[model samples]
Target: MTALSNRALNRALLGRQFLLARTDHTPLEAIGRLVALQAQEPNWPYVGLWSRIHGFTHSQLTTLLQDRKVVRSGLLRSTQHLAAADDFRRLRPLLQPVLDRTARSAYFARNSAGLDTASLVATGLELLAGAMTPRKELARRLAERHPGRDGRILAGEVELRAPLVHSPATGTWGSWGTRSAVSVTPAETWLGRPMAPVTAKDLIRRYLAAFGPAGTMDVQAWSGLTRPGSHR
Candidate 1:
């Protein structure tokens, strides 16, 4: 077997990431090609798209969010990401273990001690159904139910437990890293469908294609899924 040189590897990775040259693909297409765009901040996904897509307009992506063609939600290591609305349905369920792990982390556990996770998620889903709810308002409502628990902490845990997406206005282009207030609704409600089931093998294949070949550690780090090799 011929060994691939470092330069060749770098080029391949660049091409796969759409960093080698701008492509004529639509913003939505580019988003699909990359699986998802890193979008912790409102403007980050716009920057990511502009660098990869030729003639990419800020409005083009903003429009996708406004039209509900795309969503900004917690994905890929339980951080915010931008993915096509249809794709989000497929991706969210497969990556849910990562979100579960995040919820069980020390910070959330400490703050939300004694909170019933299953109940919190169920209530959260109920609160968001058929309506866009502000984060503070949702938290306040939840605090009333959990008496003495921090509203923000309870709300944050629910975010990890259930599928949620930010409102279009909350995800629009902005200079700030994060908004002081965010409005969200259940993902299933916004997309008008349930989250689709996907397998670990499928998740690994998609990750390799979008992220290029990688070691087990790399896959785990990027996706927050432990023991990626076992997915083989």
Candidate 2:
């Protein structure tokens, strides 16, 4: 079969990732094309956009979040990320199990010993309903629900179970360091729409569009998703 050599494949990857050359795509359009951006802290995603867009500005992303067009949330690999608001509705549901797995791991499991799963999630949802809440405050409230438990750990677990987004204030272009007062809201309520059904095929198509001619392992690795009938 005819095939792209390694060099061609590398070029394709770079071009798809918007690294080969800067495009005039707006940050919003660029974000949709790229699917998601790493936002471990408040500022890294701005750097990602700055490198890829011509005349990229910090205000562009901040406006997007302020307008509810983009959101910062726990995404792939159970880590914080920035995704377009429309895309986040789908992406979070698709990766919900990944977040769940992280909570089920030994670290979280041990930290949350004796915490009843249903009560914990229900209480969190109830508390987060109808209002945006500071992360620390959410933890404090969850701690109140289960007096002996560490509020921070319980809040973290609630995050894994519920789709939450940090407020635009926290996501704004500020210091290069992590923002200290992050606030969160339920994704559905904040976006005013429920999550889209998980369609691994469509998500994979997005993956292949950005990084294609890739092997199953490549898709699995990049997305933190695995499928049956694949090589181990």
Candidate 3:
């Protein structure tokens, strides 16, 4: 193998990420090419898209969410992300370990020291059934099941433990009018489709296509995914 320089890798990332210049690709196409979009703040993906796609509009993404073409779920660092409905299934399962490990950090660990993750996830699904729920409401419901624990902790854990998608209306731009708003539904119910199945080798290929000429650490950092036999 040949050694690659940082500048070369940086340029490649910028090109693939569309930071080099806007592209004429359709919104969904652009999203698919990138593999996933950062969406910790629901609206940030809109901004991220705008910066990369030509003639981008909020409606494009919002419509995708509403139409069940795209979904916001826990993947890529256990953070909220927007991905094609088909991508969420494979991506979420691949990311579950990362999500769980991170959730075990200070945020959820303190308040949820003894909580059963499986039960918490079930409660979250029940609370979100037939409705979209913001994190606060989801957390509150989870807290209901585990009295005396912080709702925020429950919400965070539930998100990490289960397949959930941010609801369209709440994820729409300005939906909450500047408040921290997030409405979630189960991933399957939200997408009205099943998640995709992807293997580690396949994920590696996809990651490289989107963020390639990358070292193992770069790949790990971008997607919250890991596999054995990585290069330094």
Point to the candidate with the largest TM-score: 1
Q: List ranges where model 2 is wrong by over 4 Å.
A: 175-178, 228-232
Candidate 2 C-alpha error for residue 137, in Å: 0.9
Summing lDDT over every window of 10 consecutive residues in candidate 2, give the lowest-scoring window.
223-232
Residue pairs in clash, model 3: 134-182
Q: Candidate 3 lDDT, tens digit per residue, 1-232?
A: 8877888888988999899999999989998888888876767888989999999998899899888888877788877688887878777876777888888888678888877777777777888874777788887777777789888878877777777777776556766563356677777776666656666677778888888876677777776767523311
| Global local distance difference test of model 3 | 0.78
Least well predicted 10-residue stretch by lDDT in candidate 1: 174-183
By lDDT: ranked, best first: 1, 2, 3
lDDT of 1 by residue, 1-232 (tens): 9988989988888998889999999999999989888888888889899999889998999899989999989999999999999889988887888899999999889877776788778888887666888889889998888888788888888988788998898778983643657888888889889988667777778778878757677778888888855542
Question: TM-scores across all candidates?
Answer: 0.94, 0.93, 0.86
Best by lDDT: 1
RMSD of 3: 3.0
Model 1 residue runs over 4 Å out of place are: 175-178, 229-232
Between prediction 1 and prediction 3, the one with superior TM-score is 1
Q: List the residue pairs that clash in candidate 1.
A: none
Model 3, stretches more than 4 Å misplaced? Answer: 1-7, 175-179, 228-232
lDDT values, one for every candidate: 0.85, 0.84, 0.78
